[model samples]
Target: MTEIYFNLLGNSRESYRKNLILKFLEEKAGSGTGELSSKYIYYVETTATGKKIYLLRPANLNKGMDFTVHLKDVQFRLIGPFKDRPTHSEIIQDLILKKEENNLEYEKVKPLINKLFLCQAVSDEEYRNLHFSKGIEIEGILKIIKWLFIEQDITYWNFSGRKMLYESLRINNLV
Candidate 1:
């Protein structure tokens, strides 16, 4: 089981906080057991307990604007054996469609989109195709823009969207 929290600061000035924590974990955890680098997602596994975790953080700010965000929590239990841990795609799908049925409008959706882009789950060509599709609406475009600018704030870290996606992978033992 994992508990996740999204503490939104006034606008997005504190966005770097997320990076700080992730970097700390990565350095302590050591090389390659699943990293959340600037261009890749982070994956964690506990050798003894055989537990796994993933995490992602996306932030947005408007100079002086104030905003609030939803804090998310997830719990995962071993259904059978440790060897049969859920696949990454399965976990992501579950996270995406969980109770938040209205996630399409949630502020976090933008960051998720950016994470997906880094994962190549949705390519630029696919994005353009979707954007031009007849059924797409203006609101959708606005949503895309909202994610593109604010969600990818870590571009300055030279970590690209992949790092953000890696952070998205976490198992919240705290919950």
Candidate 2:
């Protein structure tokens, strides 16, 4: 079975986080088995602010699978800014009513919807459900970011260590 790993940090101004992560991943990628290849690693920066995001997936996984992972990761990273971000219900409502009108698939959209709910990022909910464990919440967010990037065909560069993942997050409407 394929496994995913994530390391999340609170806001930090340090410039080396992306490079540090890239070096660590490159070392693992060089192992050549039971780990993602360097080619499968993708780095995306927000178009406006330049906050960076990193994505890793096994070479063998399908594009659809990879896309889901990217979305989860992006959602997780976005949670820090909100007193609580949009809830799963609110996101789903928007997707179904608006985003789907633009031709996005509901199945492809459900995971992100669920993730937003679980993360307590949705500020619209009147009563919060704190049922999900912290570990599950983190995993869900990582998976979402992975999926979103793949689906959106977001531009990503190879692991360069020179660019930080946070830079990607700083850009555009992605946050």
Candidate 3:
């Protein structure tokens, strides 16, 4: 009877360990930071023992195997895997939802926009939208600009939006 009791306990403990490992892998796979460069897509993997491993592969090639790349930490960050890129509005909404204290109102954001315009970080046309534009629309434009800036990609605009975003972030101190 002692052997039977041990068998039952051992099986249950093994099943519990497997379940815990599966949960950890699922969580990491779902929300790990990813990067898309000109040639490769990079990702970080953490082992069960908490060791970080950087991996990379051709950005456009699906059949290529993942190659390990050694790096302390990649400075660039994408929302998640390259499978999906979130929209600017979605990013802003997520931030707002994450913290209710984010001061994203038009009145608060307008000064930042004006400051960017004065500093020439944004063009005149980009700075001033339509005279009849609503407060929400203007706020959204600024938010999008900040998102593009944070992403550090100039594909959207000729000039980098980093300066404008940094200045605005300092002033707003959004959560």
Candidate 4:
């Protein structure tokens, strides 16, 4: 595979945050447990004053859809519906609605992981209900991340290391 270095940082005075993450991932991909996984992390940064949003996306697009594993402050959201349908974009709203109804929080889901075996933060059962598509359960989609934790390779730090991102709330802190 070719080494992909995205124009990534744009023209920020100090792109330390992005560079830190890029370097870290490159290291993992080059010669680490992460090297075994076909998926690599891709990110998008929006530096809008005090609120900077960093979205980590996977380079491999879904067949006719897009999949997203979004982590904001310790909360990880697995999202996808394959493609557009009767109603759309309201997906986030639906998540918000469901979250509100269930009173769910990251803390609640954090304990579900099988620390001794899978790196997965959620069980196949827990992931079942998060689908944006109509009543479909999420399966192989998240299985893609199993190697990262199955061998105890990647850690929470990859998601929110101090330099990897400017202002990040860590899974470590939450747990």
Candidate 5:
């Protein structure tokens, strides 16, 4: 599974947040977790005001789709699937070279993630109805990020010490 999130302090003057995340990911990809880790490293993209958004996926999971990100309060869509497995560098090149349309498989999902995970919005019946697309459940997506960041302790701070996101998931029975 792949996970994406909006950085909480997105437009702050400290532009080095992006560099720090890249450096950490690069080191982990190169030597920290070996070959498999490199295969599934995280990718980040920034908005015009310097807010950083990110994505992560496991090597064996979905190849993921190409979608566009709108940072006017953080929105995304899964336009289509990838032709081949993409590396972190390849993704960076694509992002730098063009307006990269990336993947997720559902158009409305990421904003929902922002709301539930970052904004700490309480989930309700309407949310459950909207959580499925082509047989994929949003629960799996939530689990992926939770495991990687909270359980694995990779950039654990991004998820609010696992408080907001985890409580939202548990309340909604999504994890």
Candidate 6:
């Protein structure tokens, strides 16, 4: 079973994602530790037997990878993973319906449209500009950027996006 919670910060300047998770586990449940990073994340579940760590890593699948984003106010977040089912298609379906209904507001759907929610943040700010890894896969990252070129109409540069993409890949040794 997976339970996801969404905390919409009234002030966009203040974000406590990791802290909040830790606090919830410690106070609401019991005392334990959770490690959050771009590469891996683990949360310890406390019980009578002691602590149990549940590790979460990226899914390296061709499709049906759960990347359910919670959009509220000025926030974009992935709740939690389910058995093997994700909400990617469901959310995309929702977006399509909203677009057809003329209710696809850019800011509200910016997380999905720009694909920012797909990347992990390495900084401590709300809007972490330095994305961990583009999309779930490096190649998929470029594809999403290409999609953004059409969706967001990035008219300035032709090769800038690709250049940056390659630079990021090289830095991460993903190429």
Best by TM-score: 2
lDDT pick, better of 1 and 3: 3
Task: Give the per-residue lDDT digits (tens) of candidate 3, residues 1-175.
Answer: 0010011011232342343233323322223234422233333323222323332332233422222232223221355643133334444443444234334443354465445333334433543442322222332334344324423322212364345445544454432
Candidate 5 lowest-lDDT run of ten: 63-72
What are the per-model C-alpha RMSD values against the true structure? Answer: 16.2, 14.1, 19.9, 15.4, 15.8, 16.0
Better model by lDDT, 2 or 4? 2
Q: Least accurate stretch of 10 residues (summed lDDT) in model 1?
A: 63-72
Model 5 agreement with the true structure over 1-175: per-residue lDDT tens digits: 2243433222221222444344434333334444544433233434223433344343234322212211222222344343222322332233222212324333444455444344243243423434233221333333233222222222334445435434443454332
lDDT of 6 by residue, 1-175 (tens): 2333323222111132333334335322213333331222333222122222232323233111112111112111356434212233433433344434443332343443233323322122322231322122222222233323222112213445324433443343222
Per-residue lDDT of 1-175 in model 2, one digit per residue for the tens? 3233434331221322343344435433334544433344444322122333445443234532232223222342333443122333333333334332433332343444434323323221211222222222322333333334233322232443212322243232122
- Candidate 4 lDDT over 36-118, as tens digits, reads 55443333221122211222223244321122332123222345542311112232233334334444443342243233122
- How well is each residue in 44-114 modelled by candidate 1, as lDDT tens digits? 21211222233332212221111111111212233643322233344344444431444334333455455
lDDT of 2 at 145: 38
TM-scores for all candidates: the values are 0.22, 0.26, 0.24, 0.23, 0.24, 0.24
- In candidate 4, what residue range of length 10 has the lowest lDDT sum? 145-154
Q: Which of 3 and 4 is ahead in lDDT? A: 3
Clash pairs detected, candidate 3: none
The TM-score obtained by model 3 is: 0.24
Candidates' lDDT values, in order? 0.32, 0.33, 0.34, 0.30, 0.34, 0.29
Error of 4 at 91 (Å): 7.8
